[model samples]
Target chain A: MTSRKLGGHFLSVMTVVIAIVVFFPIFWMVLTSFKTEADAFIYPPLVVFQPTLENYNIALAQSGYFRQLVNTLAITGFSTAVALLLGVPAAYTLAFHPTKRSNFTLMWIMSTRMLPPVGVIVPLYIIFQNLDLFDTHFGMILLYTAMNLPLVIWMMHSFLSDIPYEILEASQIDGVTLIQEFRYIIVPLALPGLMATILLCFIFTWNEFFLAFNLTITKAAPLSVFIASFKTSEGLFWAKMSAAATITALPVVIAGWVSQNSLVRGLTAGAVK
Target chain B: MSTLQNSVPTTGTARPPDKSYLRQKLARPAIIYLIVLTQIPVVFTLIYSFSNWNLLRPDRTRFVAFQNFVDFFTNPDMPVIIRNTLVFSLSIVLFSLIFGMMLALLLNRQFRGRGLARTLLITPFLIMPTVSAVMWKNMLFNPAFGLISSFLVSIGGPRIDWINTYPMFSIVVIVTWEWTPFMMLILLAGLQSLSQEYIEAAQIDGAGPIEIFLYIIVPHLRRYIEIGVLLEVLFVLNIFGEIFVTTTGGPAIDTTTLTFDIYKEAFLRWNIGRSSAYGVFAVILANIVTIVFLRITRSGTQQNKEAA
Candidate 1:
């Protein structure tokens, strides 16, 4: 009993030690963000600081944090909504109505995701320019939606697989039309998956850098671009950069904290239950 | 995409709501907009890929017949781009899977603070690629003001230019930082699904830790490991952001991967035809890789059938 308890305690202590090492960089960055410019670079690096909001003030005031956040929210929300709209039905078809081309189509869509966005970024840029969508929220939304559709469909298909067809057929027999069945029977049953899909797509677009960096200038940049504000020809502004990084990362952190309950199940979806 | 995967509610309530409007309307306002708006960009890209279009002289652009494909294949930069892409992506996939599984094995053990450890492991992944690159470049690896350089100085050593000296190494580090969490999550799921009886039984037989790990964990983890590795390979082969921020194919064209080269050619140089040819090649290569992956791993359909 003593040996077993000792082993358990040793493992627990070891886990905490590993956690601190893994988490050190992010914590240090957050701490550094609170310091003054001089404090950030000081050799023994200041562990305790005056805890000024000055860096954050500089970040928000100069970077237009709110405006950029709105752009990110709108684009991420719109793209996820678009992806879900295309994906859920397509997943339904592939799931319940399996046909000869169904598997191939699913694989093709998945393969489409493998097409390096950069392989197509330039072409898409030119397309957007021609269409007068350069630097617009709408352009980012469309690109992100199409870019994400494949994964969305694949995940939804996986989620839909768990729902036996008999349930759907029962709903159909009870006069539930295809859309009705989808909304009532399918969506409700697959709510966990739908939420997961929406969240994943939203987070993806939320943090996407290349499209935002290359496509938008100042008009509609997200917080991802907001993080790049400290970048300059001379060099980076360390304190300000850390501040920007912290700001950009905070929302996702909070979201993750709140969503942990669902995240576990959602993340492990289609894996062994 | 974790957010989307994360959104599926496990709650069994909120059923039997009126399906009236959902059925009567069958409306997908968002999907229609999604399709219509998306068609413009995709169609325009397809059109431009075929045309001899140059943004510089838009009016003079004309249809070119296979000229781009010939030029792309014959281009001096093509080989380097292909090599760079294969190296960058393949290295990340190999290293991430190896390291991810190790981390998964460690965390899967019964231990306190495991949840916190998992969250910490996941933080790197949640960061934006651009931010991650910039953070590493200036905060961690910058010779003049970076942490590594500062640490080196304290140890009586000269600082080195990581980006200039080893651009691919720099990219690998950033890419690994971001992707290891992804593989960790997948492998963790696989590890959890495994029952503990086999391992306990092995232990009772006096099998050593290393033997049990090799004989028990590795084989049982074969499918999950394959899934993790395949997904990592599929995702990594498309890496772009760190290259964009940290290297930009720099010091020479040393870091110009296939996707990056394609981006530069088509977007920066406005060589649409050449880029598209490369794009088509990329599609072919990707298809081959995924087909091999699905077969080797017995992914999707077979898994579903077994699952059912």
Candidate 2:
């Protein structure tokens, strides 16, 4: 009993050390955002300093943070939602049906993921401009959807694969249509995985800077481009930059915390063998 | 022929009214979306690559066949950019894999607080690339007041200019920080899945741990390593956030990789034609690499699984 108790105690103490390293950078960023501009760069830095909201005020008001927040939300939400609408059916097809083409299709989608987005970024950039989708949410949404669709399909397929074939067969025997089985039985079983996938896709979309930075000059710039507001012809505004960075990363951190368990499981879900 | 109506079973139970919509519910939405949304980008990108069109030139954009490709290959900066990109991506992949495997192996040893250590290691993976690059550049690696310099002085080491002095090395270090955990997570999974019976048997047969590792473990890890490397290489190829934030392809083109090159030509100079050429070239090169890797992996993956 003592040995078992000691093991538990050891793990708990280990958790404290982990909490330090894992939480430290974020802790420092948040802490630094509150420090005055002068205290921010001071050597042998003060752990404690007079907190101020002035940095956040500058970032939000003068930095155009609010519009960028909207752009990020729109693109992230729309793309994640749209990717699901396309990928769910594709996943359903692969799960219920079998053909030589099934494997090929899966491979094709995965192959797309393998290519660096840079490969197509310029073509997409020109395409966006020619089609008048430049600096537009719809344009960004479509591109981001494509960006994430393969992973989405892969996630859905892996999650769907875990459900026993018998459950679906039994549902069919009980008079459920293929679509019905997917709608009711399959979806409920895959809910946790679906949520995890959506959350992850959204985070990637939200965090993405290159596409958002290049594609949208002003109209559809996300938090990434918005964060660049602190950047200008002049040097970076450190306090204001930290404040913007802190604010932009807040959503992802909160979502990550909410789905920490599922995030881990979902990430490893696609690991074959 | 099948119906949701028939799916409710024959237990003398009443079927729901909505059971008849099965056949109507097809993947039309998905198919339409793929054709309309995805096909456009794919088709447009292909088309633009063939034309000598710059976005800024409204009326003078003209069709040019293979000129983009020719120009890309012959461009003054082409070789340098290609070399830098290859070096950056290859170095990141190599180090991340080697260090990741070693770390995974070490951390796999039953130790106190491994779980917490793991979470800390993976935290960088979840952090946005832009934020991570910025954080490292300013707070950790800045030559003037960064933690690296601060630590160096504390240890009687000299300060090094991470950006201008060693731009590529700086990028590699930060990327490794962010991606090594991804590799470790994968290798750890593969390691955990490797059964102990074989090792025990090998030990009984007079094999040492090192021999068992080389003979048994190395062969088994080949596929996982391939997969891990492939993923890392692919991500490194598209790395835009770090270059954008840290150095912006500076110090006289030292950090100018393919993606940054495309960005500079297209957005920075508004030269859509050349960038599209770069984009197409990117597609071809990426395809070649992936095809080769897959061929290599198809065999190794089977062996990898057998060991698992």
lDDT digits (tens) for residues A74-163 of candidate 2: 899999988898787778667666456766666666666665666567666666778899999999998888777877877888788878
Error of 2 at A41 (Å): 1.8
What DockQ does each prediction reach against the true complex?
A: 0.36, 0.33
| lDDT scores of the candidates, listed in order | 0.72, 0.74
After best superposition, candidate 2 residue B231: deviation in angstroms? 1.2
- Over B123-196, each residue of candidate 2 has an lDDT whose tens digit, in order, gives 67777777777777777677777667777877889987777788899999888877887787778777887898
Residue B122, candidate 2: alpha-carbon lDDT: 66
Report how far off residue A79 is in candidate 2 (Å). 1.5
Colliding residue pairs in candidate 2: A174-B7, A174-B8, A175-B6, A175-B7, A176-B7
C-alpha positional error of residue B16 in candidate 2 after TM-score superposition, expressed in Å: 14
Q: Which stretches of candidate 1 lie over 4 Å from their true place?
A: A1-12, A97-100, A164-188, A229-236, A256-273, B1-52, B57-67, B293-308
lDDT of 2: 0.74
